[model samples]
Target: MTGRGADQRTPALLLAAVLLVGVNLRGAIAAVSPVLPEVRADLGLSPSSVSLVTTLPVLCFAAAAPAAAWFGRRVGARPGISWALLLLAVATVARVLGGPAVLLAGTVAIGLAMTVGNVLLPPVVKAGFGAAAGRVTGLYTAALAAGAALTAALTAPIAGLWGWRVGLAGWALLALAAAVLWRSAAGTADPTGPAPVTPAAAGRGPATGPSVWPHPVAWAVGLLLALQTMLYYAVTTWLPTLLVDRLEAGLPTGAAAASLFQLVGILGALLVPALIGRRRGQVGLGLVVGAGWVVLFAGLLAWPAGWGLWVTVGGLAQGAGVALSFTVIVLRAHDADAARRVSGMAQLVGYGIGATGPLLVGGLYGATGGWAVPLATLAGIGVLYAAVASVAGRPVTVGGPPSVRDGGSAPVGPAPAGGRPATPPGGR
Candidate 1:
């Protein structure tokens, strides 16, 4: 292809690669949850052992996030993602080939590989898509939710026909395909050469960027992501059982409700980009998402008959919550390097705190023998999430001087190269 022709095609190819990578990020983990019973029975595993298969990846996400950022810095984001996908495919196959020990080991490998993808993708989107980052982020988040929903829905049927091992291992095909596509799209050139010294990096080398952990704005964004993730996981883990116990629903109905919770989230994910285009201040949007969570939990508490409405609304909120959090991460960072650092720090805090949600909700139900207290606790969390989202949604960049004490708002920092403002005009 001619140089101009290749340049024209690169964006589309990169987008396709990104979507494919997003699909593989959660499918392997989601597949295991649906076939846990078969896995447990066949392997003679205890309940805790079975739980580890699902929980190990989240913990690994936390533990490996910094490593992912480091890997991206060395190999560049595209190569980093491609390498991670290759490992994910191998890990998926390995996890299903043997007994319980092999399974758990494979799970750890899957988590670590996925952590690279999770941490690097936002920076890739920012660097590749530029001003259209929010819309691309929405598409990426939708792909993730769709992959998870499809895997969860299909795995049980596949396991019934074949076995749990085949069902689990089949997702390796997705990872392999993504790896091949990403390799082709990214080409052989490594983009990790020295970045231009912009005003944001004035008086400092490219390698000497500030850490995101010390920034209050980064903390706000991380807390919002953490709460959203925690609530989503906790509710997803228990919503079916909650329906069965509280509303006297049959297993089929409960299962359908759970499916709705996953599927409706796609709409929520798509909604964010449109909202970003129309509105400058995201605090109102954040409030709406927060209200969705509160209404879902409160409605379930007051009248369990409205379970359908609650689940649908909660799914939308959960989907939008994640997309918004990542969009903020992209928009708030002055450049791709900052985006990577902030993304890593945010996800480390996010998954680390979120990994406890299922355990906490289950423990509460076991002790209380009812969903009332647990649901109430989730409602309280929804309130806290709303408060944090307000802070996170502000038009403030990480490392920028704070103009307010409560993390309300701050002026954009120095513009990067090409004189483009770090944040887009009107606070997008």
Candidate 2:
């Protein structure tokens, strides 16, 4: 075949892998939330325990992200993700075994496994489809939202029919399929270099050398990503509960509404980034979206049951904000490698911070016996997002090519996940 034919086939194959992996990203996480009450009853979990059940996965996903580079280095990104899915499959089965301790443990393990996919997928997009990062990310992110929506809508009924244990275990089938597809792509190896070695001091040392980490623009991107994730996951994890418990919406209606929120988000995720990819300064656009969130939450507090459609619109705005934020990792980073590292750092700190949203909202509701305080807190976050959005939306490259930050002509830290030299594709 001609070189062009080979080149054309590569993207098609990679995109297939991306969609497969994306489908599994949230199937396990979403499966649990819809069936939480059933699982709680079956396991004899208290109300507090049920809450913890949902919280562990978010926490574990965040905690596991920082270590992705290390794991990717050790096992290779494709292999690592495959292993992660395999492990998640095991955890899914374990969760079906009918014990609180085992269920919680398995849930955490599944979340931990997911972190590998979350961290590496962006870098994979950058390295494989560098010129079209925006478009590719949109497809992948949309698939992720679809997976969440599917599980959210189907899990409860499936559980009712076959028991929650079987319902939960059913997700493992998707993961296993993803693992097989991932293994298929392993044969078409891209050239990645060796892993970087950091000394004990390296971990404790400055996050970036004074030259890179202190870049104001980098900080802006990090904060932007942090707020976007905070809001997205907060809504995904809590909105159904908010509707059911706070608004007195019936359970089925609550789940259906939240599913609509995700469906709207999937549309936003695919549409927004395409518009922004060709633009330079996106701050103003971000502010508009942030303001939309203000309206969404404020209306939620004032009119919960009657405002599901409005809240769903708000979710679209929030989804646009997140897609913009994620796209910035590539636009702002100097090159593919910088994009990878920045993606890691942004997700690491951002998700760690983001995981607090649901817990905080839940805690506030518990402490005050009302949604007022939590709504106030969420609004406060929206205000902060507006302020940060203006700065992060600007187009500025940090750690340029050949610079340590950009992952350019030189080795940034370690080699790539393929265990080769610390050089880009063909360079020495």
Candidate 3:
């Protein structure tokens, strides 16, 4: 009876740790946009260079993905995640301590740490929750959006009260908290921890079976993720500045708008599990999300004053888009190991493509001296996103034949040898 109670308590604690860690992953990055103006003034950064504050982290997400996966395999997921959180706390503090060079360096460190969390968390969810992976993933994503929203809304006010340095560094406390929680949870029990790699398995390397690289469905999924990631970061990075410049709004007003853009995403993230339950096909959801993006950019271009409606719509779409993309990743893989491999590849592809978004938007704005061209560029990306999502959202598995449809319920292959039965993807 005592053992049963302890077993039950462990998963609850693990879930809590996962949520706390999710909260830290994005808040530090999101803290930048609200105080961008102040950071620019203090650091003497140009418009294009300032965009790097957001862009560099995403670039690191791509650059560090392989290493993160390797690290997870070498050290179990719990310890890897705990270490990443500690590094996140250090990086968050380090970025605030020095000039532009230190700031960018610290940003790189933060990104590298976050990549581990981003890559490992899904497998942990799948292993820990089993049939409830979809719902838990929605919660995880909601936590992510909530953290971003809180930081976005609070940073401006905090900066107004204290300096931007203090406002930005304050988020490190959350990282520290998450680290402690994760360590506590891991100490209790870690069902999701990596299996000990025997000498034979170690010699075979981190991945076995057919590689996800040759798979077209994997590429399509990566493309969908790329578009979603690009749109989310680009908008988050520049929305406040765009509002301030185009509407001649105050910084606080602009920050409030940015906060709305992030806050409403929580609704969108939560909606995904419900949508997955009702909808047979993901193509329609993808199309609708794509349409929302198009409408958001077009609305912004046509009527800058009606920013509230456009931002709300855009925020929901961004949140759903990301959650849906990850859901597909989990649904398509045969097992947790495959999920991690596909995740590594997909994120590498997705974020590598995505990292270009903020940089390009900033450069276009700098070159053209207006938001019109940049907004149109994003809308065009939306069109392409819709087309790609149609393919990516199909009810198919990663390594399976393209014609096979699992109805979005499970992976294609047989259960991994000597492991637990392959769990259904997402919902029951």
**Model 2 C-alpha lDDT per residue in residues 1-428, reported as the tens digit of each score:** 33233234456776788888987887788777778777877789998888777777767656776687556544445556777888988988987786888888888888888877876676566666655665677677777777887887788888889988888898888888888776665433433432455541211223222223456666777788778777777777678788887767787877677777778888877776577655656777788778877877888888786666667777787667767777766566554445556666666667778877777787888899977888878888888888988877775565553344453222222346896423322111
Worst 10 residues of 3 by lDDT: 198-207
lDDT of all predictions: 0.80, 0.69, 0.78
List pairs with backbone clashes in candidate 3: none
Model 3 RMSD vs true structure: 4.9
Mind sharing the TM-score for model 1? 0.89
The most accurate candidate by TM-score is 1
Predicted candidate 3 versus true structure: per-residue lDDT over 1-428, tens digit per residue? 23223235577787898788888888898889879989999999988789788778888888788778667766755567888999999999999999999999999999999999988777667656665665677778888888887887788898899999999998999999998887766553334445555432221243443467766777888889899988987897789899899999998878787778777888998888887756435788889999999999999999999999999999899988888887777666655666666777788889999877777899999999999999999999999999998987776565432333233323333366877545543211
RMSD of each: 4.6, 6.0, 4.9
TM-score of 3: 0.83
lDDT of candidate 3 vs native?
0.78
By TM-score, the better pick of 1 and 2 is: 1
Could you tell me every candidate's TM-score relative to the true structure? 0.89, 0.83, 0.83
Give the worst 10-residue stretch by lDDT in candidate 2.
200-209
